[model samples]
Target chain A: MNKQKPSQILKTTFFSFLLIALTSCTKKSDKEVSLGALIAMTGPIESMAPPILDSVRLAEKEVNDNGGILGGRKLKVTVGDSKCSAEGGADAAKKLVNINKVSGIVGALCSGASTAASSGVAIPAGVTMISPASTAPTFTTLKDNDLFYRVIPSDAYQGVYLGKLVIKQGITKVALTYVNNDYGVGLANSFKASFEKEGGKVVTESKHEDKKASYRSELATLAQGGAEALVVIAYSDSSGQTIVRQALETKRFERFIGTDGMASEKLIKRIGIQGLKKSFFSRPVATKTSFSDAFDKNYGAFSKHKRKSIFIKEAYDAAMILALAIQKGGSDDRASVKANIRKVANAPGVEVGPGDWAKAVKLIAEGKEINYQGAAGANEFDKNGDVAGVFGHFVVQMGDSFKQIK
Target chain B: MDTLYGWMMYILSLLTVGGIYAIMGLGLNLQWGITGLFNIGVAGFFAVGGYASAIVTTKFSPNHLGGFDLPFIVGILFSMIFSGLMAAIIGKICLRLRGDYLAIATIGLAEILRLILKNEVWLTNGPRGIPGIPRPFEDLAQPWSEICYLLIILLILAIIFYGFEKAINSPWGRIMKAIRENEEAAASTGKNVENLRLETFVIGSIFMGLGGALLTHSMKYIGPTASDPLVTTFLLWVMLIVGGSGNNKGAIIGAFIIWTVWSASELLSGILSYEWINRLSYLRVFIIGFILQVILQNRPQGIIPEKN
Candidate 1:
């Protein structure tokens, strides 16, 4: 036994120590309330992540500036990348809940990430997660035990609204192409059900996986359905640009409708302003309130990345709600934060809008209830932690800008 | 105290996932390393195994079919059988192709399988995927359940490693290697190269299936994303190649090292500030590729060279 090489033993020991050092680095500050921001910092929806993450940091700074939560215990945010997939979401949630010891998580922008993280890690670990952008109705069925919440309305609402709007705009026939994931399938099914119910015919619906070299064949198949318009539900950074560009080049279907995922200036830049002139899309409205204004002003300071402002409002709102809940819950305990999240966001209290956290903290100290009306919309969560918000109708005008259409 | 536990649990999850991939790496080693068959559709057989188990075990739902509510062991057994059957079918036609052509065909098969999983809404439930998969011993409290599952993975990996080591050292394995070196020479020497290749392919795919089945159970979900060619197929190749092509122990070590690098990079991204993560969002990917390049350059025969 003693004949074994000492160098091999030394090498093995060194590697073991290195592994331990690499894995054991979580240290929670006693004077801080840590919140996790699990977002799509990479993967297919990478383009949309920066502004939303920036908004979260802005809200974090605002919370700390306003005397922090629970009498100067500063609110610190730890960001985790969801990568917009179930596995990515679950891994991120595990790190956030277990390693970071965050009282609450403020994202998971994609639906697949939201539900997966909840079932896989967050709910089991008793960590509260408030999604700012995940809108799939599938989340409504999660046996989350009251640990899951979201700032956006479900796709059910958006589908119904858009379906009605498509018909009202005199589009009688439409073909649909959606990304073949939870987000796409859920929204597509909802829209199909609503569109058919509204006496409109969906000529054909196709699902596309992301990162395909060309969607020309899918576009051709969609065009063959003799539809007057196409409804594309996909992220701008993925197959959305290619689908739009190919559809335009082939003159397959000039008239198009899109959802929030495609509501971006990048879409216009890719397809050109003239290419998308006949296109209209629906997305959650960014309210012109004090909260949004403050967010727009402060976002640049935190991040130099160009702001798309798509889900930035919701991100800010989610961060604010988590922080306020931490303050009202009176401790950094996750259970306490989860229990009191609704207390700070519902009605029958003094109204607190964006930038009013200092006042809201004062009101909470004075034994007064407060309702936080977020920059995105009314901050109310139903039994399922779902919100109801208005979807804005917009058209791409000249100069690659979105013009709100009444 | 909880932080320490959290870190431990996080490491356990990484090891568990790494263990599953180790099984896959072993299977690929049997095909590409031992038998000289480039079965690049590692994820295809994996998905087949995952769906086979998921269909039988999951409860009856309107979304998909065959919710037989079978026991967990039945699911695992069926997953292996199903994947083996698929490998047999694919190998029957594709084993005729050699080298690069086999690689191309297997990669295409993987894409075709992913498409089928996506479009066959009635069968695989399409992109929404099969969630709510019941993990064995899920009734146990969390971190404990997770730890138990990790043990299960480790047990499976150890069994596979032992079995694979024995198989590759057997007379049958020597014939496969002879065929891999020179098929014409092996055929002339009275070995049925075609049949041996097919048998090896099927056997290798069965191991991949078991790995996939275990992963699906642990994750409690299976989707198209889970079977991404880049993650499952390419990464397994990197694992086997980087660890050592023909050595079973090397394959396991490779899986652990590569998966640790993959996950650890993501963890680093999380630790870095948003400005750094945003400006260099692909830094994780860059680091992985750079490490692989360095390994490939420094050890062309792999960290553990294939034993003669």
Candidate 2:
């Protein structure tokens, strides 16, 4: 019995050591240049993520097709759904950085999700992040900073532009109705500040919680307030659509203005042509642009319907910029790649896009200067890592079409 | 100095969380410890309180509900009352079941409540949630006064604790204990066990509701995601168990200790640079589990075992 016990103990010890060695070996061999993409694939903000993910995939396919980055090392983009919540985003970020050992991350479509993931997982892991859509100003001023970058300008810039647009529309008194979220509040406050500064009067400012049915009374109140224009700042979800529909039904205001969150093809689809007409929304214009044609062609091939929203173009540009930066760095080293992102994205000279990246990459490799003007516009990352893009006011015309007011 | 201040702030934050959890734990203790009624749906009641108070206070428009912007005290009071009322209704239906069946029913109800919050965009703002809720002391001359906020919450907790203590000491508490020890024996002694259990369940739910309201105000943001089962439900259970189940002081102490550990672990993880430690985020959960196991082994009754 004693001899049998000794033999069993020895066998157990051998297996334990063998298991540890196997695990270590697996860890060492698993460096396939993993890059994490955290997007809201579910939850309230989920509608915004699918297009972003598609854009990331398109970029990945293009990179891999052209012999990949870092001396033929194929780039793998692992997408994680943040669910647009703090805890969920943090969990997704952790899994991406820890389990996948991803050197770089792109995503967190929602602002709150970005904040949660950035603070908890990405920054701590020293993984560089470039969000395509998150526009909260607070992210640029994080206390425990990391190599954070974004292709979209802050709501600060958008708010000013929106305010200017409102003033230019010859509307003096405006009624502001916003969803009670950070995204809405921040943009609304900024617009209010700049609008008031620009000599525009906001008659009645009210906040509505998102996703409630029947906004007829609120719309009526805004109408009753005798405001010429109503500014709706909210997500491009059902709630925002409901608000717009209710406003249209009431026929209260002369004009309706919406922010970027309301600048979506889904919004048009939800509200139909009749609801969308006479409504002017501020969005990053994609027409008469270099990459717009290419995006239209590529997205036309990929999607049954031609992609015509500003978000799709911005998301595509964000992915393209990240890929270009990786190509410029000549290595998958996260820190160096992160540092070089701003350089490649906001490079000097002619603007570039996914189609132009090959030539740009070759020139960059040969120590020549290049500028990447994306489909959305110039990918210029400002001092705070925000892009400076033109925010144009577009009036929805006939079915699925909008005319930008120059 | 900054580090110390941060730690102080963390402790203060934990105290606030602990106070809320303690109140929640007391409710559980009243049900499980006193009346032998098991309710795993504390989160549901808590969420109801938050949503109810939020909708009531905020104004309602044709498109969305607006907050009434009432005083925080009024909101808190309304939350408690509504939660208690909800508990009475739920208890009337499910409290008749004993043991695991009752637990399952409550848990299912909690899940249903969460789904309602998530899907009913018209009511709870769906998944996007409500933000920019008015802070209690925003109108104060010095607004960012954590001390004032802490003291106010602490005072509220004290009153609740005192009230609970007084109630538990009275004849009502004895009957509750009697029901807990042996329902049949209590019935034989001419006690209405069902009514006592229902009352205990309702009262406990009220505390949970109030705690939820207080918590929402502290964050100044309320979302369906925040009141999730994993975040609110699991944590409450951890707090109650770590504290002695039947003891209010133990509940408070457990909440404080566990929250401190959780916060400290997070801070440690944040500051550490090692790849292994940085990567091993789940290590914290494992450590918590291990510590809990050790505690259970060494002191099965908990940090402060309830005294009969």
Candidate 3:
């Protein structure tokens, strides 16, 4: 038995290596112009995926219908679930960039997932990945080699907006507890920095991990310093619901503030609307333009009765922008498409929106550049591929729905 | 030809990931298969190893300790030591308990460590984990850098695997098996079962730590999510059980099989019809569970059984 061990191991390794050698001979055709969407199809952020995915699908369908990019080559989206985690995001990105051979990727909804996907696979593979919902401030300064971009503004902007909103509401002293992760910490730190700069006292600050059974102790720690409100930065389905429920159960803090992650009716249902009495949250709002209207018209039926998440419009815009860039770039090459992203999305061009796909393609073909004012807003991507977005301040109403507050 | 090479590179990457998981599974196999020690907090030790190495090796991260900027080799060593030390502490307390108690303790241990990694921002930098970790031979160009890293990891895995095989077949391994089979009997024979169990746990954890460090270095990023207990611990357990808990080769084989299936299903879901994509995502989980069920029902000793 002992003598056979080495040979058995050698045989197994050899066999597995042979399998790899055989599989490597198989080919992936790059005939179709495929755009990959990396989203949280499963895991903690599953609730937010459907609308984003639907929006991407809607864009792909619309593009394919409208004579597709680069002389009638149909546009397709290969959807890979980021699983809203680092390792999962890396794996998803690997499949998209390597196996599927997508020209461009729109996705990796969470900040950590985005970071993981970009750094681990996307950037290394030289595949362009534009995130729709990743808002960690760290993303603003990532060493992406110009391969990464985001339609949504970083959390720094949101943090400043949240701080100003809090100050406007006369909330000087607030306890802050954010989910412990890239999104949570980035938002929390930025909010704290901005709020302190605005002369608002952060009475206490704490952080909590996701999927914990109870956070009464964390709440107690935050409440110890005696704050008027709690600013919670976390996803609604993950730590946000638990924190809100625990706070209400303990009756530690009545008034709560949340970021985009907590801006959902799902949160209201998790911790009853009655439980979220004086709570309000901030999220990026879709511009009520023709583009937004077009999105609602296209995806509204598919996403019937589901509460709209913050990044659905942004997701639509991300897909549309990538497709438009591909059209404008007039090439199937990844690098050329990446180069045209800023040119087509930014300023000094004819204005275009969601309904102008064919027109936009026509204009680009005629050598006249067109700026894509997407559903999110005038998506004039900065050098970093980030666009400034409008923020909505919403308060929970009597019927478990959020009514946007002035 | 480019497409074929792309597929080859993709497989190479997948194998790299599998290699790391196999190392982790091997660590778990040593504990559960050979010593009858159930350690579910594999992620905790992994996190400790990863974070320790990340902190020590990288230039100081703002809001967290850094600036040590040790070499990659030093980072690997630091990770192993840190993880082994953590296992020693955890083992001292939890090893007294048996079976389910140990499982619960380990689960809680991993959860607590995850919480610590999250909330202790000044230490672990909260959720904005340490990124931009330097891979070995990173200065090398494109495919070469990756290929070099893969070769290095393969060499490391080979060493660990060979050493493990040697250790398991030795008198120490027999004693471990004895303690695993009948702890009281081994104790009556003056084998010092508790001490032996502690040693086995620590040694196994050292490999796990090295695996974690390799993962962090390879990805060149580490976050709380990277060490997620469900992804790391549970998945590794499944690999061990599926591969054959008592068989070292089985552990490595199980890792490759399960990880390949896990990733390949995601690719399949992407290719499927739009209407079925969402359902297929859930079905992927079902497939994994179903595979486990089938494996358990048919080959309960796993595809490769213990060579007793």
Interface RMSD of each: 3.0, 11.1, 2.9
lDDT of 1 at A355: 81
Per-residue CA lDDT of model 3 for B1-308, tens digit only, reads 55666678788888898999998888999999999998898899888888888888878668687837989999999999989998999899899999999999988987887778767878877777877777787777768878898898888888889989999999999999998898898899887888999999999999889888998887777887888776788789899999999999999999999989888888876768766877876787788889899999999999899998
Best by DockQ: 3
Every model's TM-score: 0.83, 0.62, 0.85
Per-residue lDDT tens digits for candidate 3, residues A198-296, read 999999998777889889889989999989999999999988888888888888988999999999879988788777878888987755888777767
Clashing pairs in 3: A181-B127, B60-B66, B60-B67
The residue ranges of model 3 lying beyond 4 angstroms of the native Cα positions read A1-30, A162-184, A195-286, A301-309, A392-406
List where candidate 1 sits over 4 angstroms from the true fold.
A1-28, A162-184, A192-285, A300-302, A305-308, A392-406, B279-281, B293-308
Backbone Cα, N, C clashes tallied per candidate = 0, 19, 3
> What value does the lDDT take at residue B145 in candidate 1?
85
**In candidate 2 chain B, what residue range of length 10 has the lowest lDDT sum?**
B269-278
- Ranking, TM-score, top scorer first: 3, 1, 2
lDDT of model 2, residue B135: 49
lDDT of 3 at A277: 74
